[model samples]
Target: MNVLINEQYDIYHVAHSGVPLLRDVKQLNPDVIIIDIESPNRDMLENLNKISQFAPKPIVVFSEQQCANTTINQMVRSGVSAYVVGEVNQKRVKSIIDIAIARFDLFQTLKQELAETKQKLSSQKSIDKAKRWLMETKQLSEIDAYHFIRKVAMDNSQKMDDVAKNILSVASIF
Candidate 1:
């Protein structure tokens, strides 16, 4: 485990003790979560689901009994990025944390990029409509209409999509 203990303290290895680690998880914002539950209590697994919902971090699981498979599978479905077995040997905790954290970071990056792309696409549609309105009312060419919105954005130091919104708002008032 010492080999896996990196300089960055971004991983939290905790046990299920009837205490929700939501606050700690958020404060740590750990890239990886290693949960060790010595007791297969139903409440503990339920608590894991709740934790996963509140703070979705990469997770690797270990239990006292191998029969915890169903709950482990449920955890994976609930945003546990990676799942593995074996006890939480203090000697190996650090290595497990490192691997899970790396995988979680990659997944988060992709999720953010996709969300940004969707936002841009939605804004493009709004801008296009404003451009079309300019073409009809102002009798401008497509390129000129687009440039007109861009010019307003530059003058106001606002986003092009915001300028388009204002254009639509004023036009709609009539």
Candidate 2:
């Protein structure tokens, strides 16, 4: 492992009986992480999930045999970028890392875009609810309702989404 890693890039190895903390890895700030584990235990997998959420980095896991499909899926979902089940060698190291990094980046981008889309949908829902409230209670046209929300947002220096949410909350009691 050292021979393969040492050829192209510097390496840092932290030995631990249990799972290493995410902070330990964060401090190193490696471009990619390579873990050679005979079998990834439940605690290790859980720690990987926490690490993925806290400080995302491309991770390559080299194991002797593939675990259950559910476990493999969980690892991927938890940010294990590449899982290699075979012998590790100098020839394969760089390519595996490259693939892992690429996949990690793609996954992160997708996750971010999905979050943004969901936020936009939530905002639109809020705006629609507020507009419906105004049309029912104040007898305003849809256009008028939208204009009122926009005006309030502008006056208060807030986002239209925020203003819409405020309208819904404030009008809820009445």
Candidate 3:
């Protein structure tokens, strides 16, 4: 694996024995990671998960042991972009690395989109709550309340959700 990788990419760091994996990965910040193991263990999976959460990178694993579907799922959840259960073929190494990088890129895009969608939903909820409060306190219609909030937000160069939260906080005081 080292020889094959060295031909294509520069080896940033190699772990021979008793090396801290996560800390090294965070510091070096490699473009991708490849691991050869006899079998995937719980500790390895946990470390991979932590790496995924902190400093995400495309990971490819080559294992001699045939694992169950559950194990494969766990590996994917732990951020293994590519998992091969057989003898490592030199011919396939390049393709495998390419596919792993592509998968990782797609996963990151989807994750970001999901986070933005959740934020939008939360902001809408806050805006709705503030509009309801305005209707009750100021005797304004829903559309008028929305316009008022929008005007305030535009005037102050702030987000509507932020204005809504401020209104809610003031309402809570009374």
lDDT of 2 at 146: 97
Candidate 3, residues 61-166: lDDT per residue as tens digits? 3332433455445445535444322244534654655444445546668889999999999999999999999999999999999999999999999999999999
Best by lDDT: 3
lDDT of 1 by residue, 8-70 (tens): 443345433444544554455544344322233334433554546543322333432433456
Task: TM-score for candidate 3, please give it.
Answer: 0.53
RMSD per candidate (Å) reads: 13.7, 14.2, 14.3
Local distance difference test, per candidate?
0.58, 0.60, 0.62
Please identify model 2 stretches exceeding 4 Å from their true place: 1-87
Top candidate (TM-score): 2
Q: By the lDDT metric, which is better: model 1 or model 2?
A: 2
Give the runs in model 1 whose Cα sits over 4 Å from its true position: 1-92
Q: Model 3 segments beyond 4 Å from truth? A: 1-87
